[model samples]
Target: MELQIGKYTARISVLPPIHPKFRITPEPAAPNSTDGEEEQIEAEPISGFTCIIGYTSGGGEVSERLITCRSLRAHGTGLTIGAICHAAKGFRAFRVDRISAVSDPHTGEVIGDGSYFSRFAVKSSDKARAPSGGWGLTPSRMRTLVAGLNVLSFIARCDGYWHALEDEPLANFIERLWMRKDWEGQPPVAAILDHAKRLAPDSSIFFASLETIFGSRSSTRLLISSVRELIEADGIIQDQETNWVLAMQQHQEEYYARKGLLGSI
Candidate 1:
């Protein structure tokens, strides 16, 4: 299946299911709730996993969406998915039956209708043992991670144009931190990229705010190395990229100096 939205196109191939018999049972309604009202059955939250779906709205308009699924629940004969739509930049409820296709955003692999919900149930159960709802990182650590990624993204776009090759280094950096291939409970890469693209135009203010989030030397070094790889990915070194890196280093040094500590990078 080929999904085209404006200039972007993706080829999705359907993959066989690993758990064919998996199913999600809707949780019972609240004690005071009345009939006909939708009950939200909370399952283990699935973060990081994103899917692109060809959807036909109730009004009959057809479109493609990139969604980061947050929750799923049984609704009548089908299922309702609660997700953050990348294009819409907000949470939405999508009916499974209205969806024509569900594809992986990174690999473009189509997930069968039954297999899509099944995989969610299986992953939710598998990750039930983990204390952290997603990514296994604490709230503070996750914020720092996002801030670090934002810093790297700013450096990647320092040259004015964001090269396609830059995404490879960013993806590699995330994979190194979390060793997972299924895309479940991973970082939202698309959202990050979109945010980076928007903020790249005015980086001084954005970068300055992100700089305060990192207070450790190890993380600072990792971010610097990652930025270097991103800038070099396109094979053309720009003076703007080099200058931003130096500025980041200098800022960190000044920050640590104010705290009476050596901030050698």
Candidate 2:
């Protein structure tokens, strides 16, 4: 299937189910809730593992089984799904940590999911693959780099000046981020920021994709480090950059809290 990604049309290929990455092994049964909650009748699990997915919509855990990301799959570190959202609608990427629960859609029976990400403490940079030049926008692997840039764009505008920065590192970052094959070849920095700000009002895709990118510990660290370097590069933090930097830091704190890691400012 082909999906319109930014200015380009990407042929999205769904990965095969038996590709070793989508296999689901039996998990230890979840302990019964001793508090005497009502039990639900178990329905036959779907082969695709389709179920009621309760996720943090940032408001709270929304148990929306009807909403699934396209090309859903789970690997060693993260889970990807066909996020049936109103934003882009086809598929929005998601980080599993933001997900609170998964349940049998038919009976509303809760199912405890995997814990692959927590097995490691500090993540190594090489744990996950780096972004490619946006070739096949296969429904499986959504663009992580563009998503990261979306986050930076949001931060840049948090101070109410949603425009391009004259700062060196930030400009360089924007320059590199826009060079992805799916985007128009590095348009004027000012125009890029303008477009992003315009997209801000209804850009749910921005938040979803940004959270998805942060699923990888390495990606989170890389983004945080870049924000630090970008804001400090000029050696003069303006009120604008200060707000942006603080937003980025707040996200970092939230990420730490979710991962159960020892967080530091």
Candidate 3:
């Protein structure tokens, strides 16, 4: 994660944890359990932190709510969180690997309401389909694990922007970032283009994924900078976009100060 602090930058990396417990292999639910009874959990998540969590439904479906991270227990290769979903009515469990983002209920943005999401206007595109997987885990969780473990990190800041180009600048930026790090190793440019094409158009999902992989603060900087590039892709920065970036910049300052990362800056 890189934070543009005044004329300098604050760089930090939160490495992915290695564990095979990211899957969910549960026994078939008893037909009678829907009568207000709950499934037997392996264990419960430790209680007390109240926040919001984004959970992956059967497939590519996404749902968010203010939830209390209650108890945590090993599921498969990862863990399951016992939480109370606030959007609906009651206590429930969420796959740890599938959690999109967690944030302070009162003060923090729901991970995407900040500068990171101010770019890309919603396209009203048809919902993307997620591969089927049930009684186990959703396909999104596995992809999350893969991407987290092997991050094709992008490193770039405001360079040359506000220039007109009919070509795919964002796609080009993605390819160059990966190649510069040699992380994904020289895939044909076409492959990178395809990857970008397949990327989730929902900015919230992407931001949540980042928070799930990295920590909240780390994801904040990364999300903001990347979105900044996307916003400037048209070679013309709009008033709304510029204001959102400024708001995010201020958000980062208050955040770091709260965490003391800005004390000596």
Number of the top-ranking candidate, with lDDT as the measure: 1
Q: Write the per-residue lDDT of candidate 1 for residues 27-116, one digit (tens) a residue.
A: 343464332212222212232235667888999987777665545667786677776555654457788888887765444557555335
Runs with alpha carbons beyond 4 Å of true place in candidate 1: 1-137, 179-201, 209-213
Candidates by lDDT, descending order: 1, 2, 3
TM-score of each: 0.44, 0.35, 0.31
Q: How many backbone clashes does candidate 1 have?
A: 0
Tens-digit lDDT track of model 3 for 1-265: 3444342222122111212322212334445333231222111112223454556775877665555333454566656656445454345666766776654443443443212211211122413343222112123322333232122122111222122341255455444444443432343455433333222111112222333433344333334445556665666665544543553455445655666665211
Please say which candidate is ahead in TM-score: 2 or 3. 2
Error of 1 at 140 (Å): 0.9
lDDT (C-alpha) at residue 37 in model 1: 19
RMSD values, in order shown: 14.0, 18.0, 17.0
Superposition error at 181 for model 2 (Å): 15
lDDT of 3 at 207: 26
